[model samples]
Target: MRVLFASTRGSGHFHPLIPFIDACTARGDDVLVVAPPGLEASLAAREQPYRIGGEPPRDELTRVMKRVLELAPDEGVSLMTTEVFGRLGVAAMLPALEEVCRTWRPDLVLHEAYEFASVVAAERQGIAHARVAVSAARFSRSTDALLATVLEPYGPGITERLRTSPYLTRLPASLDPSPYAVTHRYHEPSRPGALPDRWGGSAEPLVYITLGTEAGAMPTATALYRAVLEAVSGLPVRILLTAGRGTDLRGLGPLPPHAHVEAWVPQADVLGSASLVVCHGGSGTVFGALAAGVPLVCVPLFADQPANARLVAGAGAGLAVTPTGGPADDSAVLGPDDVSRIRSAAELLLKDPSYRARAGRLADEMRATTPCRELIGTLDPHS
Candidate 1:
C-alpha cells in the first residue's frame, strides 16, 4: 500500500505524523510525506519519502489568513466552530496540494485535520483518506463545547453545514497519534537523554520548561521564562529551559547555578526524567508529560492549548496560569499574579503525593487507549 501523508509546516504539526509514517513503512507499505519545502529535509532525514509543495515563505502567513476568511463563515458554523478556522487554515494550502496530487497519486491520503487542501484533493480524486488529530484535547468533548460557543454567532445552519460539508463528513475517520500509549509509560529516558550540558548530576527537583515549538516564538517567551525563573529561583528544583529555535535567549543571560537554558532538547528525553513539566500545553507536550506520569504546570498560548490545559488540570494531572485581565479562557500569558499562582501550584504538586498518583493513573489510561499503529492496522486491514 502507498500512503500519502499531508500536514502543516511546523514541528508540532509534523512530529506526531512521524510515528504513523514509520509504522506504515515498517509494515512494508510506502509512505510519501507532502509538506512545505522547509519540512522536506527533516522528513527525508527520518528516511521517509517526501515531496515539497506550498507557497513561498513570504506569502505563507497571508495565504493562511485568506484561507481562514474563506472557510470561517461557512464551515465555521459547527458547534466546535474554532475548527472552522483551523480547517480553513488548512484549506489555504490548496494550491500546493493540487500540484502534489497531480504528480504523485497514492492509494490513500492520511492527513492532519488542519490540512484542508490535501483532503480536498484526495476527495476530488476519489481516494481514501483519514484525518489525524495531533492533540488529545482536539477530539475531546471539552473542545467540542468550547468551539461550539465560539461559533454560536453563526446560528443553527452551521451545524447542518458541518455534517454535510465536504471537509468533515467525507473523511473515513479522525485519529489522535501520540506514541505514549499509556500515562505510566511517560517517563525519563534511560541514557544519554536530551538534557542540556549544565543539568548533569543536578540534585534539585527537575522542572522541565518549554513552550511548544511554534508558539514558543511569541513575545510571551521571555516573560514566561522570567516568571518561571523568579518563581523557582530560590526553590530546590533545577530548571531546564528549551527556549526553542529563533527565540532570543540573550535576554535570559547569566542563569543561576540551579537553572540552565538551551535552544532545544528532545522533549521526550527531558519529560521522561522531569519531576514536573512546565509547558505551553501543546497536545504533544501535554500528552508526553501525562504519559510520563509527571504533573504539569500549563501556560497555554493559543488555539486548543488552553482547553488541553483545562482538561489536564481538571483531571488532577496539572495546574494552569494565565496573565490577569486576559480573557478568562486565555491561559497563555504569565503576569505577576499568575507567576505567584503557578509557583504555589507547582510547590503543592511537588510536595503532594496525590498529584503524582493521579498523574500516574491518567498515564495508564492514555496507554490503554488505542495506539496509532493499531488504528492504522484497523484502517488498512490488507496492509
Candidate 2:
C-alpha cells in the first residue's frame, strides 16, 4: 500500500509523524511525506526524504490565525484554537497535495487532524483518509460536537457540512490513530556526542528546556529563555537548552558552567535521559515527554498551548504557565511575578516525589491507550 503523509511546514508540526512513517515503511508500505520547501532538508537529516512544496513564511501567529478563520470564522476561539487550525491547514497545500495524490495515488491519506485540507481533497477523490490528532482531548467526540456547534454560528451550513464530509467518514473524532504508540515506552540510550560536554557524566537531576522548533523563533523566545535560566539558577541540576535556528542565544550571555546551550539537539536522546522537562507545550513535546516518563512544566506561549497545558496539568502529570493573566491560577502567565512562580513550580516538582510518581503512572496509561498500527489496520483492512 502506498501512503502519502502531508504535514505542516514547521519542524514541530512535521517531526511527530516520523515514527508513524517509519512504521508504515517497515511493514513494506511505501510512505511519502509532503511539506514546504526547506522542510525536506530537516527530514533528510533524520534520513527521511519528503517531497517539497512552496515555501510558507515563518509567521506562526498570522498563519495560524488565518487557518482558524478559514475553518470556523464565527467562533470567538482563543489564539490557541487558531494555532491548532493553522497546523491543520497544512492540508491547504492543494497544489502539492493534488500533485502527490495524482502521481502516487496513495491507497489512503493520513494527516494531522488540524490539517482539514487533506480530508476535503481525499473526499473529492473518493480515497480513504484519517487524521492524526496533535493534542489530546481535541479529538474526542464531545469536543468535536461542541466545536461544530460553536462554528455553526459562523456560517449557517458549515458545521453540518463538515459533519457529513468525507473527512470523518467512519471513525469518531476522539478515537483517531496516534503516532506516539512506541514513543510512550521509555528506552534509555547513551547521550549523543553532539550534546554539550557538561552533559557528560552528570549525576545531578537533568532539566530539558526547549520551546519547540517554530515558537522558539518568536520574539518571546528570549524572554522565556531568561525566565527558565532564572528559575533554575543555583539549582544542582544540568540544564540543556535548544534554541532553534534564528534565535539569538547571545542575549543569554555566558551560560553557567553547569548549563549547556546549542542550536539544536536530538530531543529523543535528551528526553531519554532527562529527569524533568520544561517546554512550550507543543503537542509533540508534551507527548514525547510523557513517552519518556518525564514530568512537564508547560509554558504555553500561544494557540492550543494554553489548552494543551491545561490538559496536562489537569491530568496531574505537569503544571501549566501562560503569558497572560487569566483565571487559571494553576498556570503562571509570563511577567515579573511569574518568574518566581515558574521557579517555584519547577522546584516543587523536583523536591516532591509525588509529581514524578503521578507522571510515571500517566506515562504507563498513555503507552497502553492505543497503537497506531492497529488503528491503521482498521483504516485499511485490506492492507
Candidate 3:
C-alpha cells in the first residue's frame, strides 16, 4: 500500500518517523512525505523525495506568537494552539495535502501529531490516517478545543473523528499524559562509531549537554547555554556539550576546563554511557536520557519543553529549572540564580541513586512496549 507521511517544518516533527520509514521501506511498502519547502533537504539527506506544502505566513504567525508570549502559560498555550497550530498550520498545509492525497491516492496518512491538516485531508479523501506523537504524549491542554475550533469549517463530526482516530505513541503508559490506543517503543538510532577507549570505565562521571537543534536558534537558549557552561565549570564531573550548528560559539570565549564543546555529535552513541544529562527538555532528549538510565537537569526553553520537563520531574527522573523567571519567550536570561539550581540538581542526581533507579524502571517499561512494525501492521489494507 502507498502511505503518505505529513509533518511540520522541523526536525522534531520529521525525525520521529525515521525508524518507521525504514521499517516500512524494508517491508516493500511505498512511502512519500508531504512537508514544507525547507524539509526537502532533510528528506533528501535521508535518501527520500518529498512533496512541498505551502509555507505558513511567518510574519503573521510571529505576531500571534509574540502575543502568546505575554499571557499566562496556560492562556499562552491555548492561544498558540488556536492561532499557530490550528489556524496557520491548517491554512498552509491543507491545500497541498489535499492535492497530494488526491494525486497520490495513498491508502493511509501517517502524520506528526500537530499536523491536523493531514487528518482533515484524510477525512475529506476518505482514507485512513493516524497521528504520530512527537513526544511521550500530547502537551497542550487545548488540543480538543483547538481541533473543534479549526475543524468547525469542515462541518460536523470532524472533530470527533480526529479525537477518536488512531494515534502512534512512542511512550509507555507511565509517561504518557493521555491514554493511547496504540503504543510503539522508542529506539534511538545511531551510526556505527568507535567509542573512547576508557568510555564506560571512566572514573570521572560523564555529563552530556544538548538543547536540541531547534533550541540553538533561540535567544533564550543562548542564555541557558551560558548558564549551563558556568554551572558545570570547575565541577569534578567531565562534560561533553553538543551545541547545534545554529549556535554561534565564537563570542562565548574559552570553555571551562571540565567541559568540551562540539557543534554536533551522535547523541545515541554518547548517551549510552552518560552519567547525567543537562538539556532543554525536548521529548527526544528526555526520553533518550531516561532510556539510558541517566538522570536529568531540564531547563525548558519553549513550546512543549516546560511540560516535558515537568513530566520528568514528576516522574522523579529529573529536576526542572525555570530560569526564565516567567515565560520562556520572554527576554529573561538564565542568571546566577539558575546556576545554583543547575549545580545542585546535577550534584544530587550524581550522588543519589533513586533518580537513576527510576530512570531504569522507565527504561524497562519502554523496552517492553510494542515495536512500530507491529503497530504499522495494523494499518495494512489487506489485513
| Cα TM-score per model | 0.77, 0.76, 0.91
Report the CA-based lDDT of candidate 3 relative to the real structure.
0.77
Sequence-dependent TM-score of model 3: 0.91
Candidate 2 has an lDDT of 0.63
Q: What is the C-alpha lDDT of each candidate?
A: 0.64, 0.63, 0.77
lDDT of 3 by residue, 57-110 (tens): 779978897898777766776787777778888889899999988888888888
Off by over 4 Å in 3: 138-142, 180-202, 324-331
C-alpha lDDT of residue 69 in model 1: 38
Residues 232-328 of candidate 2: C-alpha lDDT, one tens digit per residue: 7668899988888779989777787778888888887787778888888887788777666788899876545666687668767788876553245
Question: Residue 374 error for model 1, in Å?
Answer: 3.2
Best by TM-score: 3
Clashing pairs in 2: 80-303, 80-304, 88-114, 88-115, 139-174, 140-174, 322-333, 323-334
> TM-score order of candidates, best first?
3, 1, 2
> Which regions of candidate 2 deviate over 4 angstroms?
44-49, 55-92, 139-200, 324-333, 370-375, 381-383
Q: Cα lDDT for residue 58, model 1?
A: 54
How well does candidate 2 match the true structure in TM-score terms? 0.76
